[model samples]
Target chain A: MNIFAPVGRAFFTLLAQIGRLTMFLVEVVSSCFRPPIYWYHIGQQMMRIGYFSLPVVGLTAFFTGGALALQIYLGGNRYGAEAIVPQIVVLGITRELGPVIAGLMVAGRVAAAIAAEIGTMRVTEQIDALTTLATNPIKYLVVPRLIAAVVTMPILVAIGDSIGVMGGYIVSTQSLGFSSGIYLKNTLDFMKNEDVISGLYKAAAFGFIIALMGCYNGFNSKGGAQGVGAATTNAVVTASILILAANYFLTSILFAK
Target chain B: MTTPKIELRGVKKRFGPKVVLDGIDLVINPGESLVVIGGSGTGKSVTIKCVLGILRPDEGKIFVDGEEVTHINGRARDKVLRKFGMLFQGAALFDSLTVWENVAFGLIQGRGMGRRQARDIAVEKLAKVGLGSEVINLSPSELSGGMQKRVGLARAIAADPDIIFFDEPTTGLDPIMADIINDLIVDTVKDVGATTLSITHDMASARKIADRIAMLYKGKIIWHGPVSEIDNSGNPYVDQFIHGRAEGPIKMEVRG
Candidate 1:
């Protein structure tokens, strides 16, 4: 009986946390549709969450695309089917590597930043002051980030797809003895619009998850510097996990026959 | 006979199993300066938070100008909040914004005023707080502690609110600086003619700024009176608190 008590408490705590997160999500989504949307803040966040993320997202996708091409070529060598490298690289980069890598990287960068910034505001009484000053913290703080991430994520993923395919093209034409024109042709011909569109859809969902987790953890952070540190760590960890989990579910749903 | 500017009726609040504000009833007339004094963790801050709608009371009602405002939120609460300005304990200036921008935040974000007009008003308010335009472009972090508090004071009064709150307005400054801040607060509240509520453990500040003083103890307003009558209140708790003594009915909670 005594042993079961701790388990029961832990279960209840998890349920409470889920309930709180769900409420926060509903509040943020509702606030997004309300009037007085801060266009300036949205533009600022887009620059931060999307434009600034390009370098890191592009670099990660490029390296991953090159590595995927190498691995696929080697695997195809065993079966005497190395001719399939360009086609597979194009398919894999468009469908999986671009969205997933970009999502995870942006989650690490943007989510951590949002959490740290908002967490500092929370501990310092700025949030309460906002309330007193007739400003809604959710509308002023959370909604802009949510809107920017949702609107800019697909653009980021699209650019990542192009850069990733180019990475595979460079690797294939330069290192794998494949001709540039034929490899480009194979890459272009093998890619379908559905693959790219599906990844973009996944990217949009990942963006929402990243912003939601970041804002939620930051809003609820207590104490001081230590509390903010915990919130930042939690934002990154939760955003990454949710992106992967959401990716799996989205893949099954989007691709199911 | 006129309705009280602010009223808290049997308001109560608690967190988890630890009760912070058990029950409180307080009032301030229009254009009056009321200060709440209590030792650390006696719920002085929570009382102001309850009225400002920053924290919802678990029970009872709050009224501003004779209208019930308890439990109101969203735009309705924002409407009520329009009447308020507050100087926080640590100033709480937005570090991301320059000094003028921090002061102008309420005007621009709340009233939808243009940036240029707001900046002019911010400059004007900063002048009232004894800060010059030289500090306008610098971040809050660049200013000294006393200067930050002044900027915070400027921000608070920027909108010309009908009510103002001062939360420990002189916590971390030198004695001379604290006196200067107290004088600024007195002058600004007078100029704005706003009903003022201040909470502090600084007895000197309370004495200087309060027309009426209330002492909170164990989550209740145990004693309250005009500032002149505070010395003759005949309450042992008030006596111990004002003289800054540890030996009295109020025992320090020493946790091992």
Candidate 2:
């Protein structure tokens, strides 16, 4: 037996998967431009992916912000720079933690749900039923989810950013004994509009990744219950990883100057 | 001669090392019901899927109304598909939609009809399937298997399609319910005057609804004839299959 045979097979399998995903992505994008946009489905998905996700994303960002404040205070006290806590906290929350945390959290919540739903449809032959009815599955399923996620993530991230800053403010003013006005002033003065905007940009990319991964995994799922379970798990894991990976690249590009 | 409603010639499909359909050839005349009977994993479903363009054949040609459809795509494929309707083995109703919505789905989504108009027609179709107006608003999951099959039948015939495909129309129901469904299928198909191609291993269903019966074994049609001729086709395979005998030329692949 050739030792390289298994390695070559795995490589080819990976390549084939990449090719399939690329094709799926192209189909989804093109379908977005076609007629019968299904605005009702898009609105429903927005409510599910965005509106319902508000509390989770907000809570996550708030806690993250509070923790960052505490950490900054501890680390800054050693350098006698504890007064810089508010400045750094706002910057961190708006520029990095807010979008990334919300993205990852939403990926875990929404991507898994989308995958399981679509994967079940696939296994049950409902997707085939949709096809037989002359409804393009991508247009009916993927495009709505994609549009909802892209349109909603930035808004979700923006809200998350505000909640996160408020969290930092609460922690600093109440626990750290900083004046509320001073804390707010530092937060506002230190944070550039560009920082918040860049985070929203990352959020948009992350949203696309989350919906794309979910739809792709779900659409391709086979077997039965086990397959749907795998699709759900794969959607979350892949979306989370892609969000973080994209965050780094997006950050570098946006903040390069 | 009138053109066959749907025709498959030299159709072949395989997954990896396993060949599922080995050059299948068949024809269904308009308004005739052709049942392709086969055991599980015998490519009966694949054959139907190939004709529906859900699964493309590895090799061969498919014609619908004498128009070549094997390689059609996009709007053209949709146009071809609009001529057909299907009832999946498990009913395959959308849990998200109510029974009436499920029936009207092809009308509203595919044909772009107004929702109220589609719903009205959906209700009318449900009534034809012997479902009351009450069940129209209920979700599919709330219905029993037999009811779901009725709803599926309603959906299949809702659009008044030119050709309908039934994939194991009676697989998961009681014998009485199965017979009921079979009768309903015959009545509905007659009402619409639609050609049909059904795949099932159920002899009872095949006998009741099929004008012609085709037996698929080991990836090919072994025998096909009028339902009246199925019992005496003189093919041992068909005899053994219809009789449900374990000992025959067709051996079961049982392993301990």
In model 1, the clashing pairs are none
How closely does chain A match the true chain A in each prediction, as TM-score?
Answer: 0.98, 0.98
> Where is model 2 more than 4 Å wrong at Cα?
A1-3, B254-256
Candidates' interface RMSDs, in order? 0.7, 0.5
Candidates, DockQ: 0.89, 0.92
How well is each residue in B1-256 modelled by candidate 2, as lDDT tens digits?
Answer: 9999988899999998989999899999998999999778889999988888889899999999999999998899999999999999999999999999999999999998999999999999999999999999899999999999999999999999999999999998999999999999999999999999999989999999999999999899999999999999999999999999988998765641
| CA-lDDT, candidates in order | 0.94, 0.94
Q: Name the runs in model 1 displaced over 4 angstroms.
A: none
| TM-score for candidate 1 | 0.98
Q: Residue B226 deviation, candidate 2, in Å? A: 0.7
Per-residue error (Å), model 1, residue A179? 1.3
Highest-DockQ candidate: 2
Predicted candidate 2 versus true structure: per-residue lDDT over A1-257, tens digit per residue: 99999999999999999999999999999999998799999999999999999999999999998999999999999989999999899899889999999999999999999999999999999999999999988999999999999999999999999999899889989899999998988888888989899999999999999999999999989999999999999999999989989999999999998
